[model samples]
Target: MMDQPNPVRVGHKGAKVSWRKSSYSGSNGDCVELAELGNSVALRDSKDRQGPVVSVGWRTMTTFVSALKGGHMGAGQA
Candidate 1:
């Protein structure tokens, strides 16, 4: 299994996070928004802006994105 960083709550630290959606997202509303919070990054469903948020370290977020781009992450074969 892949190691993952523990999620952090979006408290006062991220109360004012400026979230942005990827330009690749379609109008289907199956997209997520990302916000940079200093050393950490926050992610939330774009359709549910006030819903739950997942927070992880900046390095972890970058690594995860790289893995996704390289097709190293998927449903199985961890």
Candidate 2:
């Protein structure tokens, strides 16, 4: 699986990363931030900038998003 999170801190690897969140996110500060890391994507909590970051392959992220949009995985569907 490409869903495992990298154990290093942000910018620790000296790679340039710009974190951004979905515009649909509410102003209540509940969302996740994403950064493009070459062939992979990095995800972090918007509320915890210094928290853990999960990195997944670009293709994996794309497929995951597609599943969400297609309603393949839902509340009770694993």
Candidate 3:
């Protein structure tokens, strides 16, 4: 069995965050948005910008991004 990742539970639902989606996301807008909040970074779906947000430490965020770039994880999207 694979271990599940811990959920980022820093921010609450509908929190106001300055999020920026990836440029490669294109105009389709089906992308994830990220925001920098002091020592933490927040992520939310572009399609639901006003929805729940996940906040993780900057180091953790960078690690996740690195893993994504290295193909260690998947986007889980079509």
Candidate 4:
């Protein structure tokens, strides 16, 4: 079995985060957004910009982005 990664701590209280939705996201209401802050990457719901943001390490974020591009998140794969 694979070990799950621990969630990283984030300070979204006053973060001047610049959120951007996924290019693959269409006119649909379901979409995720991302932002960069120092060595961390912030993730939030595009529909809820004012909601909570989750932060992760740069390396982890890289892996996530790669997986996303590879359609590992069930975005394009049928």
Candidate 5:
């Protein structure tokens, strides 16, 4: 079996990254941010800018976002 890419990958040695927040996010607070770097997508908490980053593939990210919008992944469930 091939090794799958990890969902989380931390940047080291001062790599330049451009972060962006979701447009659907509320102004009050509480949102998730995304950053597209090459073929990878980075996710981070809006409240905590300096928090841990989770990196995923573009296709995987698209599927996850689509599922989220389609309500396929409900709360309180894995």
Candidate 6:
């Protein structure tokens, strides 16, 4: 069996991070913000820049996106 990495939680810090909206996002303004920190990637809600963040390794982020695209991630069963 392989070891699974624990989830990351990023929040409650006064530090500043440069976050940008995804280019693929629409002009509706409901989007997510992304920021890079060395090997880690941080994501947060565009509507709440000061809200909680979800950070993960660059590789992990890639895998997650892939899963999303492949329809491998979702709530419950379809």
Question: Each model's C-alpha lDDT?
Answer: 0.79, 0.82, 0.71, 0.71, 0.76, 0.74
Model 3 agreement with the true structure over 1-78: per-residue lDDT tens digits: 322334464356876556677878878767888877787777788787557767677777778789989888865756
Give the best candidate by TM-score: 2
lDDT of 6 by residue, 1-78 (tens): 322444345543765667788788898888988888787888888887767777777788888889887889983567
* Residue 34 lDDT in candidate 5: 82
- Best candidate per lDDT, number? 2
TM-score against native, each model: 0.77, 0.80, 0.68, 0.66, 0.73, 0.66
Write candidate 4's Cα lDDT for 1-78 as tens digits. 322344443444764656788777889889988777787777877887767767777888788779888878996556
Total clashes, candidate 6? Answer: 0
Q: Note the clash tally of each candidate.
A: 0, 0, 0, 0, 0, 0
The stretch of ten residues in a row with the least summed lDDT in candidate 4 is: 1-10
Name model 5 segments beyond 4 Å from true: 1-11, 75-78
lDDT of 1 at 21: 93
Q: How many clashing pairs does model 1 include?
A: 0
Q: Per-residue lDDT tens digits of candidate 5, residues 1-78?
A: 322456565566788777788777788888888888798888888888777777878888778779888889995577
CA displacement after TM-score superposition, residue 40 of candidate 3 (Å): 0.3
Task: For candidate 1, write residues 1-78 as lDDT tens digits.
Answer: 444655555656546667899998899999988888887888888887768888788778888999988988883465
Angstrom error at residue 13, model 1: 7.9
